[model samples]
Target: MDKLRQKDYFLFASAMYSQPISCSSLVEQATSPFVSFHQRLGCFHSDWHQHEWGQLIYAEKGCIHVNSRTKQILIPSGYGVWIPPDTDHEIRSTSSQTNIRSICFPVADNNGSLRQTISVFPMSTLLREMIRYTNRWNQGPVDEAQATTFLQTVQGLLPEEIDKAVIVYLPSTTHAKLLPITTYIQTHLARPINVQWLASEFGLSVRTLSRLFRQQLGTSFSGYCKIARIMRALELIELGCDNVSQVATDVGYESLATFSNNFLAICGHRPLQFIHSKRLY
Candidate 1:
């Protein structure tokens, strides 16, 4: 097996905003338990980076792709990606114009295990609104008890476990020759894509590509594609795509029956049923 490169295994981001003069920072600057909100423009690019304080990253208006050492998470609006402090991760906007709102908090104590991986959570509407309100309080000396109470309420709502569907972990190898192929498959899910073409484009043998997929993703290329398609379908359904047949076609499945079968197999329910339940919730 080929050895992984350090650069390939990690992402780097250079831009970060440290909070100023807030009680969260004032009281806890040494620990740096503070919250700040940001609006990122279309051209902004945050390379891979880590911080002393764990971060709660949420998107108020857009979506982002987050990659930790172990997995990659697609954080859309209403979802937040939690990074324990000192975990190496990268972030990029899915849309050209992306708007993000985030809260950075210091962990009560430095626990190395907590910083080991990315934990994604559903950002409930109430929690989102509360963060917005709390950010309004100036960073000067504030009532410690009230501030602590607000922080506790924020922490209390975080779910113990997050249900995530699509996550890609980077290998130690620096070879990203296969990444373009994966990116192509993700971006063109609605269209027909074949291994022969992918291999040809990358100047690699089909067998080599297959082996790479199995090694890097722990699944066959076809399986990865199906999972990716299902994830996209779920996102669309959540956004009010009620017609399952159309969604199936949109995600590159030729037959509606086949799409339904695959969707049921992966999601354990029919697409319509899933969407209906989501609506009820």
Candidate 2:
């Protein structure tokens, strides 16, 4: 449970793995299952790389975009992404001054929420405090006696109870027919979303597209489109784009009242309140 020096993590992958195709061997014998670090994200980037240790990444500020072979996920504040050991992944920040805190754990699944692949966890108040506390402890001096107790208590714990922590899940799917339509919908959210119109444009019958949505995503076309618009609207607000009315119009809502209602329903916060609340957090 000893804290690592700056150079330790620089050679983290190399020290833990000689083969990029790492296994659980290194993690099995780790003295400490956790290592925490704070990093500021800018345009700085890394090539797709991996470690033998599983990682849980928390964005304390702004947004983190992660890309791997099967999943490209966004980790917003108050959310954590659990990346399994030996998985190929890359990370980027949408904002220049974004702050990220990551905890790397040994590769083990001991009846917990950690998955063999990437999983998103919602951060609870306690989990958030634990993260900050651990980081502060690591950065300050260490007491040999307390370090062992701290490590034992915190290392394998999940951020929150799985059900309680769950939030927006934007699944990136590979279904052939659904892929193009979903992409088109997300891209063209500024325009009205009409399933029949899409069916005409994509050369599929409206019934066929509706069936595809049911089979693949388990949601109606209108349901999915509304969520997409709300997501985009949130992004616009986060980017400081405009007032609520302007954002509503920008995302193709005919009226601010309609936009506010949908935004509240989907996000659990009014548009302006959400923006102000995010700044407070």
- For each candidate, the alpha-carbon lDDT, in order, equals 0.61, 0.64
Poorly placed runs, candidate 1 (over 4 Å): 1-32, 38-44, 69-72, 94-99, 110-113, 138-145, 156-177, 200-205, 231-244, 256-281
lDDT at position 217, candidate 2: 76
Tens-digit lDDT track for model 1 on 127-206?
Answer: 66776666555455556577667766665555443344224222222349778888888778888889988898889999
Worst 10 residues of 1 by lDDT: 2-11
Give the per-residue lDDT of model 2 (tens digit) for 114-229. 55567665566666677677677456665646755654455446634334442243556689888999999876777788888899999999999999887777778887777777
Candidate 2 whole-model C-alpha lDDT, 0 to 1: 0.64
- Among the numbered candidates, top lDDT falls to 2
Which residue pairs clash within candidate 2?
A: none
